[model samples]
Target: MWLTNARVFDATGAAARDGRAILIEDGLIAAEDQAGAVPDGVDVIDLAGRTVLPGLIDAHAHVFATPPTPDDGAEPLWPGLTAHFVATGLREALRMGFTTLRDVGSYGDEVITARQAMRYGAFPGPRLLTCGRIVSATAPGGRFFDGMYREADGPDEVRKAVREQVRRGADFVKVMSTGARSVELEDPHPAQLTGPEIAALVDEAHRLGYRVAAHAEGLAGTELAIRLGADTIEHGMYLNQRPDLLDEMAAAGQVLVPTLSCYYGVASGQWTAPLVRLARHNLAEASRTLLAARAAGVPIALGHDWQPFSDAAVELIRLVEHGMTTHEALLAATATGARALGLDDRLGTIQSGKVADLTVVDGDPLTDPVLLRDRAQIWLVLQRGAPVAGAVFDNSAAIAANARTAADSRSVTHTSALSNAGRPRSGTTETPG
Candidate 1:
């Protein structure tokens, strides 16, 4: 497939190229040429001034669970129902152009099952990397809801807990290293696990060949994770207190996945009152700290961290508004995220030999990142060279017919011949919406 005459943000540099053609063959970007030459009989898709970006990657999320809605009046559901909701959430994420995501602290092993199903072509979903459950302390505000976290006391139990997740085939280990806003804590700076306990957990996870992601919000917890060699730091909220720490993180090459969208939402009154109060104080600090970290060369990865999937775009906008350039934010949502998951060689950038997981926007994302948050602006979504959403197979008629239905509903009937829904391939042109 040859995608031609479009502005392409390859995610490897600050600028997008115009009038370039991306040659995709066997789910990989074969070449991106300015001459727009095509082999005989090759399918050429003219993008008509639209922009192509490497499919966005969300570094942290509970991909299997949906955020609570006001109209959701049903009683608590069983595990099966919860899994169903999770699948729905993952679909919404894919339609939003997140072709790759990390399920950090998925409530149970359901993500593992979901990952297997996606691999087997059960349904169209994003490429998922999952950490089965979070490891936390037994103290107050340490352990989260049952199924979401495992409570372990000392080093021995922390080590055991991490091993259990690895045994369950978890891609990584998520450890809660400090208190968060949702927990009932007097101050957020206290570390949940002692230094030795966290060290043991990190060691066990690394030995098992899995990266360790620390859920750190406070200064002490962030320092502990950094000192102990955690692979990624999730929400380093109190990073401003010690500017030197950002240098250490940058020097050590630890990726930071700060879910600024949560605080942004809270400050905007999307969350309830008590949480809003907490977020009001932390939001400014977090914003300043993020800028300092970026200036110090700390690699940032975009994560919604249980925020709605669309908030991933919002997070990128916030990063740009706070301090990062638009290209830096794009790199955070792509290259840095893939690097955090250890999949940079296969995904992330739109370079040759990388998977052709790409998102085509109806407008330039560099001018307005909000286009990513708007469903109508997403023209096409391709996962591994096959369309999973948007106007596939040149079917603007189908997309127009389903215009009233939201991309998040997971009810739009994808044309079998052009999608990854276990269908036959055919010659078709997918145009901008």
Candidate 2:
């Protein structure tokens, strides 16, 4: 497939070009194959006024469905969550232009199932890396968080659980290292795992060929996760409040996923409305910490930690609002996100010979990050060089529609959920890629 008349923008940090084209062969970018650079015997697609870019990757997401009414103050438990529900939302994600996602948490192995389906062409979505269930000790997490967690007491139990998840076809493991904001469905506490336990999860994951993601949001937990070798920190909003630790994470080449929007959403009177004041203060501090880390040479990637709709692009804009140069925010979402997911080798850029996961935008995002926030200006998306407008394209509109429903008016009071209330669910916590 040849995509012509495209303007390519990617993390190479170069200027956006007009009339650029991409040649995709066998689901990989065979070459940049610029405008009028087509080879013999290939189909051509005249983009007509569109810009193309590497497919956008939302590196952190929960490919699980959410319950309609809060989880009745209980962590939403699941043993029956289906892959279809997740697949339902994935169609929307693709339409919204997100070609890939990382499932950071799920109540069960449904995320893994969803990933396999997409990989084998049984479903539609960007590429995925799924961390089975999350292992949370008694110190902090509560029951409402559901099957995603494995409550363990010692290193042995933690190690066993980590191995079990890998055996279940997990691409990675997730662990809860610290306490989180108080919410009804999720009872929050503090650093639930000790240093040894945290270390055990990471060590075992590495040995077993899986990366471990830590849900760390406190000083002790953050430091411990870093020390224990967590591959990524789910919501490092607290890192800004503790620069020393953030600096340490940077120095170690560790990645930080500041689901920066989730915290701010909490402040906006969504779920956990009463804590708005506290969330606000935390938001300011969180932004600063992330900025400091970026300045200090830390690899900061953008993760929505959001349901499909909350304007995922808004998550990137928030980074700019928090002091990241527009270029930095784009990198965080593009090159940085791919690196965080350990997919830098193929995805993240628009260079020749790279996978054709391009995201083309109208003005240079480096000049104005908000340009990315404007979905109307997104132009076109190429997943391995296939247009969103053609066959073999993942239907991402479904994800955007789902997100719109989430951001739209809800008949239920916000009291039933957490901050910035999340995605629509049919009793499961499934988010499309």
Candidate 3:
């Protein structure tokens, strides 16, 4: 299959190239060639000069239902219902142009089950990589987060916890190196685990050939995780307070997933005053940390640790607003994210021999990254050379009819096909609402 006449952004932190075409065979990118160099008898899908990008990746997300609030007076959903919500959330993520999601935490084993379901083709969804449950020390967070935390203490216990997650089919391991801001009983500043415990956890995970994603918020814990060789730091918002750690991360090739959207969510919501205050403070510090990390050459990846799977693109816009360039932000969501998840060799950029997962947008995202947040602007999404979701698939009947009529007139055009696909074009260059 040939995807022709498109502006291709290979997600190499570079500008888009015009009049390019991609060749796909057996679910892999075969080659890249000039748009006008297609051989005869090849199936072609013209993009009408639209922007094509590597499929986006979210490195830190939760697929389970959010824990209930005390004021809501509702019990947690049943296990089966939780699984259903996980499935729906994953499917929604795929429709929004995300081809891969790395879930750092989820309730029980629902993430593993959802991964199995998607792998078996029970439903169409993005590729899933999960950490079965968050490994936390004995703390108030275990009670606050319910089934999401796998509480353990001591070096031996933490090592066992890592093995347990491996046994549960986890693609990676997540360890809480510090307390959480959301739980009022817990403080976000101090380290939650002892040095030996965290060391054992990271060592065990690495020994097993699995990457460890450390949930870090405070400077003390952030330094520990960085020094202990955590593969990725989940939320190193206070890293600005410790530039030395950022330097170490840059040297060690550790990726930082700032998760800026989660702090924004908490600060803007009707949460308790203290939690909101902490969130606002962390949000500001995170902005400074982002700039410092960039200066230190620390790799940053996009991770929307918020709800509503469809709004994942908001992280890209947020990254740009914080300090990164639009091209840098796009790379954060694509190449850098894949690197964070240890899948860069197979899934990040658009190059020969990589997996054929691509997203087609109606306008240039470098001009206005906000267009990625609009569902209507997602022209087409392909996963492994197969059309999975997007405006094109949603309006296939109309597109087919228009193609037939255009063929009769001998004036078929990709623009007419897009018009029939019901894509909204007027707001493609608009700013965020």
Candidate 4:
């Protein structure tokens, strides 16, 4: 498949050629050049004045569990992961042009299921790397009952916990280096993991051949993870507040995945009162941290730690609004994120041998950064040379149809329910008032 006549913008910036074409063969970008360079027999797709880019990547998420966690109490495990919900979320992600995502945690086995399905093509989704769960301290504010949390007091337990997650099929290991207001479910200000404990987990994870993404939010946690050589710092929201920690991270060249969307849920009043209060302090800290990280020369990647894929993509735009240049934010979602997941060899930027995960939008994202968030302008989302999920967004009706389909499905679900069991059946369907 070849896409031609569109603007192409990526890590290299935006460029327009009269009739340039991107030929995709065997899921890798085979050739990109002037039109008809690949021969007439090849499938040619024309993008009328749209902008094309590498398919986006989300670095952090709870892909298997959309709602994040349920209101379960004292359970070692949260509700299990279902193939259905994971697949649906992946579908939504792929439809939105995300060709790859990294799940920071999963409830039960859902994320693993989704990852396997996508890898095997049973379900269409972005390429996935998954962390089974975020291991935390026993009394840590972020502990989630019995679900994925494996409580550890010291280095010994932390090391064992990492192994357990790997045994459970985790693609990578996530160690909650600090307690944050968000996951506490109660406590907003939490304690940081000891350096030794964090180092233990990191050492074990590396030995097992998995990259480590530390849930390092507070100053101490961020510093500990960076000093110990953890792969990436997830949600270094308070690293800016602690100049020493920021400098250390910068000096060490640690990558930062600032998940602004996590605070978005709290500040947006989407969470309960306690979580909201926790988010209140976090929001400002996170904003400041992002700019600081950028200034300190810390690598910043786009990781929508939010539940669904759309929210993650929005974080890409938010990164720009905060401090990142359009080019920087795009690189975060593509090259930076791919690097964080240790998949840079395959995914991320556009290159001759890289997978042809590409997206075609209507305008240059760098010039008008808002174009990155314009779902309607996304004319095409291709994975491995195939048009997957919803049709290209360039077709106005396709966009409207997709939107209407969502609304109609929702309307039917909420307003089209049958009469109550004991009540008389109504001849007409009751609509949402």
**Model 3, range 1-433, lDDT digits (tens) per residue?**
6787789999876678998989888778998767755544444677764788999999999886544356868776664876777778887888789989999887777878877777666666778888888999989999998889999999999999999999988889999999887775888678898788899999999999999999998777878888998999998998998899899999999999999999889898678887789889989999999999999999999999866798999998889989999999999999999999999988889999998889988888889899899888887887887667787766765334322122323333332323333442211110000
Instruction: Output the TM-score of candidate 1.
Output: 0.88
Order of quality (lDDT): 3, 1, 4, 2
Higher-TM-score candidate of 2 and 3: 3
Cα RMSD, each candidate: 6.8, 10.8, 6.1, 10.8
Instruction: Give the candidate number with the greatest TM-score.
Output: 3
TM-score rank order:
3, 1, 4, 2
Instruction: Report the candidate with higher TM-score, 1 versus 4.
Output: 1
lDDT (Cα, 0-100) at 189 in candidate 2: 33
User: What residue pairs clash in candidate 3, if any at all?
Assistant: none
Tens-place lDDT digits, model 2, residues 39-124: 55555555545556667778788766754455556464465655666776676666456777787777666767777666666655
Which candidate number would show the highest lDDT if scored against the true structure? 3
Poorly placed runs, candidate 2 (over 4 Å): 67-84, 139-142, 183-190, 361-376, 388-433
Better of 1 and 2 by TM-score: 1
- For model 1, the stretches where C-alpha displacement exceeds 4 angstroms are 67-73, 76-79, 141-143, 185-187, 270-272, 391-433
**Native-to-model Cα distance after best TM-score fit, residue 102 in candidate 3, in Å:** 0.4
